[model samples]
Target chain A: MKKRDIILVAAVLILAGGIWLITRVFFNDSGGQLRITVDNEIYGTYDLKQDQEIQIGTTNTCEIKGGKVTMIQADCPDHICMHSAAIDKDGGTIVCMPNRVFLEIVGQEDGGVDTIAQ
Target chain B: MKNKIAFLGLFAALAIILGYVESLLPVFIGIPGIKLGLTNLVIVFILYLYSWKEALLISVVRILAIGFLFGNLYSILFSLAGGVLSLFVMYFMRKIPGFSVLGVSVAGGVTHNIGQLFVAAFVVTNFKLMYYLPVLLVSGVVTGLLIGMVSGEIWKHVGAYIRKNNREKL
Candidate 1:
């Protein structure tokens, strides 16, 4: 690798680290809600603080407890959504592309940085 | 010209096979966008051996073929977005001073994930998809570097062969 190649790799690594750090430090569950959407329409929103199981149209199910949400069940062939990490204080997402269902953690006010694009 | 066309077709087929191979493996890290991106090896090789246009053509054909055979329409859209953006980035990076194959491939890999997230966010109408940004970025860099290294080595060999052929033709 040349000088520029190292520089490029270093830059990307630093950027990734920075984003991870920022999300870990700033993303919290204070008034956060788990918003589930199906086919671009709102399915339901659940309080992150609540300990309950969400069955999303028989395609998938998720559980929220102690301010963390996990996809406990999914009918998708890959089961990737269920394998995804829980959305805790750091904020995360679970998507079942085959079923066209997705879940995300959004702050009541901030809604994360991607919302600014709107 | 015929030789180049034949090479391009071969590379495209190779890319599709790589995609199929990738699908056979389970998802890495259980994240949606994180994968070995093995086909990127073919893409990086083409970008170095041929040009951006040929790379773009091969990538599109490979993505479409892979999607139709192994994935759904949604995956095809995601591949299109990622493939095009990565190719575009690699094309420009190649022209910049001091940037080598590794740098170009790295840029391609990183931008590929960003482009995929952009489409996912749009399709779901939710920017919260950005949550995967950090993981995807790290994965991109790692996979890009691996693909870049392999392609760089291949180019060292195949590049000489192609140059000799060109000299003979001229």
Candidate 2:
């Protein structure tokens, strides 16, 4: 094996491991989602009902109906979120990576206002 | 050249299909642009089958076709960066005379992801996005290994056939 082989393997392993670890930290449910940012905006006590619509980030749009929020449209290049269906239940999350928006349903953890940005 | 082009076209089709199929597969991990990269097998196959230029062409065709068909416009740049980086690594590995294409593939995949990450870090106005690089790299390793192993087996079959056919012609 060339020294390049060793270097490449080590580099990939270390970086991938770190990203995986951070993903776990961000996505893993603990107590509840402390913050929810849709397009980097901090909305307070986001109340939702059936058929309520909201735009996520700049590209994607979302709606809530029957106490569930679903992505309606995404101008994002991938439209992965637009392809992703709605979330009507608790503990559901939506991510638009290109738009850099993350939407989450924070359950009755503290049951009050909280800072929703990292 | 026509026969060679025909063979290349076939491989390109295979790579495109693999790329699309992989998109539908559930994320082994949740990070975007991070996946098993099942199609790199085609790249590895090309690396073994012909010259570096041929392999590089396959990589370009496959990445562009899949990106245009299934992904957004920005994907083009990222794919280009990754493909170029991968071929560079593969070219070096090929210099070792009898270097295993599988090993070359592993290097390619990892370096491709690295290239993508580097571009993301530099291109994006917000530097915080670099945070995602760690995960993309990790996924690259596993996927690279998978493509490597499969391509290694495939190379055996393709190599034997090519040798046999060439000898008959000679």
| Model 1 Cα shift for residue A47 (angstroms) | 8.5
User: How large a fraction of the reference contact set does each model reproduce?
Assistant: 0.80, 0.47
lDDT of 1 by residue, B6-112 (tens): 88888988999999999988877665568788898888888877788888999999999998998878788888999999998999998898988888888988999
Candidate 1: residue A62 Cα off by (Å)? 23
lDDT per residue as tens, model 2, B1-170? 66678778998999899988987887556545676767778777776667778888888888889888977555767778888898888888778654466568777877888787677656654445555666566666777777877878887897678767765442
TM per candidate = 0.70, 0.59
Tens-place lDDT per residue, model 1, A1-118, is 8998998888888988898887777763356789999999999988887899999998899999888889998888999888888886456788889999889877654433332222
Instruction: List runs of model 2 lying over 4 Å from the truth.
Output: A1-118, B97-99, B167-170
lDDT at A50, model 2: 33
**Which candidate has the highest DockQ of all?**
1
Worst 10 residues of 1 chain B by lDDT: B161-170
